[model samples]
Target chain A: MIELQHVSFERQGRPILVDVDFEIDRGEFAFLVGPTGSGKSTILRLVIFDVRPTHGVVFVGEYDSQSIRESDIPHLRRRVGVVFQDFKLLRDRTVYENVALALEVTGAKRSGVKRKTLSILSAVDLVHKRDVYPDTLSGGERQRVAIARALVNDPFVLLADEPTANLDPETTDQVMKIFAEVNARGTAVIMATHDLRLVERYGRRILRLDDGRIREDMGLVKQV
Target chain B: MGLLLAFREAFRGFWRTGMVGLISIATIGASLLVLGIFGQVVAGGYALIDRLQERVEVDIYLRDNVHRRRALVLARDIEALPGIAEVNYIDQKAAAQEFQDMFGAGMLRALSQNPLPESLRVRMTPGSDLPQRLQAVSDVANSNKDVESVDVGETWVGALERFVQVITGIGLLLGSVLCLACGFAVSNTAKLMVLAQREAIEIMRLVGATGSTVKLTFLVGGAMQGCAGGFLASMGQSYASDWWTSRVPDLALDPTIDLNFWLVVLGTVLGVVGSWASLNRVLSAVSIK
Candidate 1:
């Protein structure tokens, strides 16, 4: 579960996000739809403690983002799985190595990392391409590898930012289906995307943002 | 289990960026090498001073026209002094013979008369108060007005001690500067290596890798480098000592080169500490990313 209350982030005398309040409860799939520069990714960064909120509190599990010590950020991050639009895999490593890295950093034994990596890769339908490097993979496959990596730790909440931005329509549908499956398995998923069509098709809880205000619509919300 | 896992991650990291690891090790080694060489020089200087000290003796010359029996009696009295380790009375005839052997028999024949005075050669104990002992003996001999000079190489000893002190002061300053420079270089190199692994590090941080775990990887990498450098330096020092000592036949003239336990230990500590310093800056600046 993730919660943000009256959170405002500013840098260098300019505002990035203003008084944003949102929560993703346990086992609930949520959508964050916003225009460019609307602070969607900033919100995700705040939840993960990558960047601190200037004016409000952000909580992941029990961690208080605004007041958390520098050392506690890593612990907080371990409990939350994050999928980036860039598919930030180590280019030199294989898909399996990228996924195993999550467990590896947690000080998992080699046997354990291997077991968890293979299972997670299979979950994302990337079992066969486990040994393949990121550069050799297609955009869809790379995103799948990233998903596998995010899921390797079996985090309670998954935050995805434009995961399907570079994927084809068919690949986008596949990736969305994977999110649906992950959500169905009781892992809460909060995705930030501009694709209103996917929102209508999936019909999940939607939180739209325009001019730094939360506009919640259950279904078919019109974008300004 | 924890240690094993840490090492596994370290090796895995080493494999991922083998080149970076090698460069870090090489930097650590080179820094330690410089430290080792300076240490050996100081050690060698001390040994040379010690050898010279063992062979050292002060000559006490008796006044001319003094009775031979009186001079013999004076020698016995001074030889009984508290600080005297050994006393050899080189009588006039013995002194003349020593001069002949040193400068050759033809040189002594060229002189019309033997001008060398009968002298008492004194060797002092290791912890003897050289100035006080020399003064005490000189006073007793001069009291009889039968002593010409009491030579302890007074000015020369003072100069040697001062030279040793200056060398020690300079060694400390240079060693400290070398260590600081090595630390800066190692940290900069580590920073670049961290940059190379920026994404991998982010993922590690996200997955709950403790700050210590990441830090230890770099530290261990640095330690390995230091040890390697130390070993290479030690080997080089061994060869140099052998080659140099073989060339210098007189142990008294040759400097002392020591590879003592504590010196090696100091060099090792410098290498490790330098690495630690570099890693601290590197991990702090890059951990957030």
Candidate 2:
């Protein structure tokens, strides 16, 4: 579960996210629809505890952003998966290694890393591409690897930031289907995106952001 | 397994950095060699000074016209003295033998008479080389009727020891400053190599890796550099010392001085501390989100 209560973030002299409040419960998929600079990424950052709220509290499960110690931030991160439009995959590593890195960070044993990484890669339809490096993979494949990496540790919540921005339409749909399946499997998903069609096609719960304010918290007619 | 991964990562880093890693190791080894040699020279100087100090003792010359029986009795008294550790009596014939040994048979054959005097070479107690003790021992020998004069050289070894202390202090200070400077320069260059590559450390921290876990990789890398550099430097030191010893046979050097182990220890400290400094500076500024 993630909550942002009356959170306001300012960078330099400009306001980013002003007096924002929202909550997405466990096993729910929420789309964060917003224009550029509407603070979608900042919300994800707050969830990841990269930056504390200037005036309000952001909560990720039991961790309070304002009160979490630096030493405990890594533990908090272990329970959440984050994906980016850029893929954020280590280019030199093979798909399996990149995914295994997720498990490795948490001090997982070798056998567990192998098993979990392979299982997650298979779930994302990337099992065949396990031995290939990210630079050699297609955009969609790279994005899938990122997703597999994010999911390898079985994070309770997933935060995706425009994961399909640089992806082709067909790949975008494939990526969306992966998210849909992940959400169906009981992992909460909060995706920030500029794609309105995804919001319409997926028809899940949507939070529309305009000028740092949440304009709409609309629930879809049929949830995936 | 965690340690294995850390070491693998470290080796991967070393390989990825290419010439930077080689240059770092080379520079580290060169500086360590200098430090090792400096240590050896300082230690050698101290040993030489100690040997010379140990040789300092009082010498009592017997009256030239005095009876040999009285001289033998005075020698026994000097031996019984509290501070007198050993007494070597030089009778007229033994004194002439020493002169002959020094001057050679041909040179001594030119002399009309034996010029060497009967004397007692008095070595004081092992640690009783204090000026007061030396003077007291000399005074006891001087008061003897059979003794003409006693020579203690006014405890000049004390001044030599004080001088050696100053030199040792300077050597330590200079060595420390030089080692620190070299370590800083090399670590900075190594830090650049680390940052020049993809920021793997940031990624490592992003995915739930603890700070110590992330640093473990870098620490292992630095330690490897240190050990390798230490080995190279020790080899260089051995070669240089050997070359110098061959050229300057008069200079006494301790072949058994095991500075290799110490060099490795020093190299380890330099590597770990340098990498720690660089990693802390870089890692602290990065946001782990």
**Best of the candidates, DockQ:** 2
Q: How does chain B score by TM in each prediction? A: 0.74, 0.80
Q: Write the per-residue lDDT of candidate 1 for residues A49-78, one digit (tens) a residue.
A: 888888989988888875799888777777
lDDT, residue A114, candidate 2: 94
State the lDDT of candidate 2 residue by residue for B266-286, as single tens digits.
Answer: 787888888887887776766
Candidate 1 per-residue lDDT over residues B39-137, each given as its tens digit: 666656666565555665778898787787887788788888877778788878899999988988887788898888988887765332455776777
Q: For this target, which candidate reaches the highest lDDT against the unseen true structure?
A: 2
Model 1 residue runs over 4 Å out of place are A217-224, B1-35, B61-84, B88-119, B126-161, B224-243, B249-289
Docking class for model 1 is acceptable
lDDT for model 2, on a 0 to 1 scale? Answer: 0.81
**Residue range with the least summed lDDT across 10 consecutive positions in model 2 chain B:** B124-133
